[model samples]
Target chain A: MTGIEPLAVAAAGLMGIGLYGFCLCRHAVRRLLSINLFGNGVFLALILIARRLPDGPDPVPHAMVLTGIVIAVSATAFGLALVRRQARTRGDDET
Target chain B: MTALDSLLALLLLLLAARCVSARSLLQAIVAFIVLGLLLALSWVRLEAPDLALAEAAIGAGLLGVLLLGTWRSLPLGHGNERIPLPWQGLRPALITTGCTVLAVLLTVALHQHPEQAAMSGLAALDQLDAAGVDQPVTAVLLNFRAYDTLLEMGVLLMALIGTLMLDSPLPRDTELPARTMLPATLAQLFLPLILLIGLYLVWAGAYSPGGAFQGGAVLAGAGVLLILTGFGEGDGRDGWVLRALLAGGALVFTLAGLLLIPVTGAFMAYPQGLVTPIMVLIEFSLALSIALSLLLLYTGTPGLRRRGER
Candidate 1:
């Protein structure tokens, strides 16, 4: 009923959508995109929760999310590298 | 619910769904970028300006560039075969249904427990004076849980090493045709602008939402642009200075933390009045290291060299 509640619901919905895509998508690139969407959904929920604080926005969750963002990017970069190597190897084998 | 919040939330949900459902990988990547921007807006609405800036820079800007670059480098139109299985659709439906139910239950429980106070939040807030920084998020990062940051830097280094080890030997240099998509004049005009913005974000991070990660990502984007436009090549080997730049952050942070043992009697503890300066130094070094690391990752190489150079 509140403003925050709707955002939470929307984030939940996004998470569900992301989960479905991750499960169904066979392409590594598409799966990467799905994983990021899933991450963004979780971040939305965390940020919304941070807004519920009274005096000032909660810094702890903000910090946690910042760390999460960097870690997510790192993991995605690693995954992308893996995908590229796999593709290159597959191409080489076919040749 | 406020009209604006509802609108933003709806926009985010739509973009997120589209990102997953788009048939073309390129279109899906673009949609994912839009979703990241909307998520940044959502973070801003949540009163987390720091996270908003980070999401905009790293999440949308850098990640978008990385995805596009990777998409370009791969053999095109090769991986979109739809699987033929009788239970394919049913499996996803069941999984999503279960996840949705669990998420809803968790959200309900969290909402009901609104009165619970976060102890870590309280502790960090209480120790603001000792942190020598006015920003609580920065304090939390560089002071309260600095050990986590240290380990994270290690993980990034390991990933870079792994990528280098896995990369195939460089192809022979051929006179490749120039890319017409990005004009030289346009690139020259935009390069300085991107550099300025990256520096601004890094410098502004002390009191605001901008920080090393976002700034580093933006810097890496600039590096990626240079490589794409032929100003630099995505060579897999780096010279000594480049290696130093890549290792500087972790090196400085680790050494600083180690040096504190004698003066402050604990690891990673800055002297009573030196926290801000120390944190800033560490952050600057981190920004540079992270930028270089991500750029190298995009290149899928251990090092970068100028075109035509061995």
Candidate 2:
């Protein structure tokens, strides 16, 4: 173990806030936003951990994070579509 | 540098809190977008520029557009009602306490930095020449861990398919709304430049932070700009060409990996003499598919058409 990094502390804070938001927010879209915030925290944590290596940042984790971002974005987009469908089904399509 | 990192860390926490606690969805959306950009900055500080690029493009940029569009499509006051806590009385407090405990545990767990943990990165770097890519991250993605990337493309495709099943296209606009000259002019001026940059990014990924994901997201942004500016619009009719392009990346990736097994005696291992060209082919095809899939997801449609086309 080494001295705690500030970014690690921030990552924890993000995860906490995201979890709180996800639980408290009633709107499906807001909940999605919260989940994404949580995902961001996890990504940040991984990136920070990758920095722990002596010579350079770990490319394996970097590649993983890249893949994770794409997956997150795609999943979020799909979730958004579902939200739109739900609203339309509820007769709230007044856009 | 430590001070700057501390400031960024503080900013990230504050922004995430604000994003979650804002009264209005619009405010929360804006806060989330800013948080995403700040996260990208933090990645750069952490020495992961490839992740930073992907985050900035897909995580912040494209996701922002999708969020805003969804917000616009939802009826006014539809989801803006009172946001009560998940439960009454002590449950909210209990949840908050639980989250805090979880955070603490995660932080404590993350502090351990064993010297042996560096072996994977060191091994990747040691064999970078044999991997056929200059950038270690690219090598890890397109070569060393090509299987993971291949399956990721499948996940992306499946997501697109699921979205399409919803049968709800985003509000289609055949032309730009009145009095929006600036967006139209900007799209016209920037479309070519954006296209060029996106392609350049794909080529540069062989030796840089840019790659299929980032490059594809940028190209998707270009498509979004066109759609928003009335140059192109989502069409309900499905076309073979669009379908092929949408599935091209995963198709090429699978074929490349499978076809190479006989030549290299292992799945996804490129022949020594043809590694670069094969990677370039796989990279470009993947970019094309990713870009089209994302664009379609944004459109919520099966096809896209020029504004005036039948």
DockQ of each: 0.60, 0.75
Candidate 1's residue-wise lDDT over B93-130, tens digit each?
A: 67767867866875675456455676778788889888
TM-score of chain B of 1: 0.87
Docking quality category of candidate 2 according to DockQ thresholds: medium
lDDT of each: 0.77, 0.87
lDDT score, residue B203, model 1?
Answer: 75
Q: Which DockQ-derived CAPRI band holds candidate 1?
A: medium
Q: Ten residues in a row with the worst lDDT in model 1 chain B?
A: B168-177
Residue pairs in clash, model 2: none
Segments of candidate 2 deviating more than 4 angstroms: A92-95, B81-88, B172-175, B178-180
For model 2, residues B1-310, the per-residue Cα lDDT tens digits are 7789899999998898788878888888889999999999988888887688788888998899899889888888666744555355687778878988998887777786665767788898889999888988889999999999988999899999999999888876434573268988898899999999999889899998888888898899899999888888888788898898888988998998888888999888999999999889999999999999999989998888987688
Q: lDDT score, residue A83, model 2?
A: 94
- Ten consecutive residues with minimal summed lDDT in candidate 2 chain B? B80-89
Q: How close to the true structure is residue B252 of candidate 1, measured as C-alpha lDDT? A: 90
